[model samples]
Target: MSSRIREQLLSLLLEQGDAFTSGEEISRRLQCSRTAIWKQIEELRKEGYQVEARPKKGYRLVHRPDRVAPEELKPHLRSQRFGWSIQYHSQVLSTQLIAHDWARKGANEGSLVLTEEQTKGKGRMDRAWHSPPHSGIWMSLILRPTITLAQAPQLTLMAAVALTRALRRETGLDIRIKWPNDLLINGRKFCGILTETRGEQDQVQYVVLGMGINVNTLEDFLPDELMKVATSLAIEGGRTYHRVTLIASILQSLEEFYDAYLKQGFEPVRILWEEYAETIGREVRTETSQGTIAGMAVGLDPSGALLIRHQDHLQPVYSADID
Candidate 1:
């Protein structure tokens, strides 16, 4: 079945909402033949949608799988750009790798690549990200902004602020931004954002922003070391959450903040980021490629670098591990 017809069929079933629609009515509504409708219904069943067919009443939607699909998310999305066009996968090596290729092939500005399981998930410095199957949010967004290359780092901070705000409102948990990219809960890490740009010397062609969030993973299932340093919303909030809903909230929030950051400049987003930042005004030890620097975390610079107040000089760190 064609992608267009597949989506329309699911949409119609969902709209009917427990009530069965006759085959004649569906064919007339979608302008397709009864044979085509039957094929598409079978396709939906293969994709995990439970559809019931009866002699008199044609089809009824019974159950929608827990997996996140664009058809399932369209009704919940409020964003104009983000998540409008999506590439969803059950498993992949990394969504970032696919997103980069999609960007090069003329994918939309806000095209998103999402995966339920990532076998080789990546973190900062190529560190392994513990992404269990069907337990976390492993996704990437392709962004083609008009900002200069020098201003790209601010996007990471802006995303951190957007996700932090949305997760707090959705989960009702205390989540804080830890320096450049990580999100913390009670001093334990819960989320990480990675931003990579593909461009020339003076221009930014596009950016692939990858986000990994531990939503419903249980704490006891994690490794010993990860249990000490990592946590999830289910663990912190004492309950599980629907990943589809969380994805919609995140996309909506990021698109809102991203539009504002572009029109109003980084100052506005910076202010909001500082509001939920746990790194500011605290003593920190950062391990940069240059060396390890331990000092007081003062504020962020214009380019989104973390500023540290040492002996007498203030230093800006572009990338580091805050220990």
Candidate 2:
């Protein structure tokens, strides 16, 4: 669906400033009915905006808060492919599920599916992701790489490197990667990445990289069960940072890393990924479908498969539960 009209409606509302304009004036100016204006305004409210309607005085934009609306974020986005077709939702079951469907239906590579909140969001290993309504950045990037399926794991590592670079540049908060695909702040979890793919053994049709970041969310907003395990940017930085800037930074970094990976292969990206990886060279406990493996994390192979140096030999861990 084209968000241009809704965006224009939002822009007109924002341009009017604090002046209370009549609904009839808005309808005449935007060439729409007062009811249409009222409906869109209510939709904006559902997306975490604060608009005030004072009797017959009409609608007043009390606040133009940072929302995932295309109008609010389009100006800040600098991607050529990523986010070119941005989808915004007030609340959804999962952005990953939406992105997967879009990809299957021929959504362009780097197309973004974002929601202010995700009701059935997912994390690594089909875990339930905590996406509070209108509190964090829930997004999924649809990527169609021409690389072989064997090389697909590199994309997850590549995403971690890209996100680390983006967080450092945007929030100025030192972020690190925890092994495969978790972002850490001060040794605590801040972000989780779930990379799901659909393809054959030698070729990949498309890949969905879903990232759930705790942006301006407060500690109290999270459940007590997660308070100690999960953290947000606000908790780490002690202030609220703009979500648009974060999104733009991530796209830019992802584009750069993706370009490098496509041209130079995963060697360079893997080196950078390892530099930011908190699991490398650290003692870790890994759980996989086969069983569990405890060893000193050596690093990653050229194919982005993690290398765990166990008692008698170096084991190539394709996928595992990391600790």
Candidate 3:
């Protein structure tokens, strides 16, 4: 269904409150035939909306689903740019790959690639990310920032800060950023972010930020290896969360931080990241491709690299898993 007609139908149902609105009444209000109204109602049902239709009572809106479809998010989204253009998929290989392809084809900045499940989702260092159907938030955002290639890494920290703040506000959980782009709650991982950029020399053409969050994933759905280290909002909070609301909140937070970083600098993002960082001033073991380095996590550099005070000098780490 077109967003306009869906919006009109939802508005009519919402305006009616507990009362039922007949198909003829909706047809006249939306300026469509009764058949069209029925079809739209079926579409709404397919999207997880509960619409009750009786012989005489007509149609009544019962419940709204927690899906992350465009129509579901349009009514809740508050951003001016981010999430304005969304490519929603029920299942895909990876949102990062699709977003990168769209970015290369000149897709607009702030365009979002969202999926309910990913067959081959990956994280930093090419690790498979478990994305169960209708249980997690697996998305990638296409950004055409004018920042230099060197400054692009800060976007990962920016996303971490945004996701941290959004989850804190929504779930009231004690969320913390673990290095480059991981969110932990009570020392268990719940979110991971991977950022990919394509550029040359000092200029950056575009960046695709992939985010996978375990929202309503149950314990049985997780792999045996991940069961100990990973967790979900439902497990932590003892309830399921509405994915649409969380997505809208994260998009708004991202747009706010992205604009701030562009106009001001990385200082604002750095400060916010530090406030929510879980690695600072702790004994950490960073495992990079070269080898493992164990030291005290001092802080972050201006460019968002993890700074580890390894004995004599402070070493800057660009990529690694903190243990």
| TM-score sort, best first | 3, 1, 2
Lowest lDDT block of 10, candidate 2: 1-10
Query: Candidate 2 lDDT (Cα, whole model)?
Result: 0.85
| Local distance difference test, each candidate | 0.90, 0.85, 0.90
**Residue range with the least summed lDDT across 10 consecutive positions in model 1:** 66-75
lDDT of 2 at 122: 91
lDDT of 3: 0.90
Candidate 1, superposed: residue stretches over 4 Å from native:
289-291
- Model 1 C-alpha lDDT per residue in residues 1-323, reported as the tens digit of each score: 47688888888998999899999999999999999999988888998889999999899999987777777777778888899999999999999999999999999899999888999999888999988888889999999988888998899999999999899999999999997899999999989999999888878899999999998899787778898889999999999888888999999999999999989889988788888999999999977777789899888877788889977789998877786
What's the CA error at residue 310 for candidate 3, in Å? 1.8
Candidate 2 residue runs with Cα over 4 Å from true position: 1-62, 288-292
TM-score against truth, every candidate: 0.93, 0.85, 0.94
What is model 2's C-alpha RMSD?
Answer: 3.6
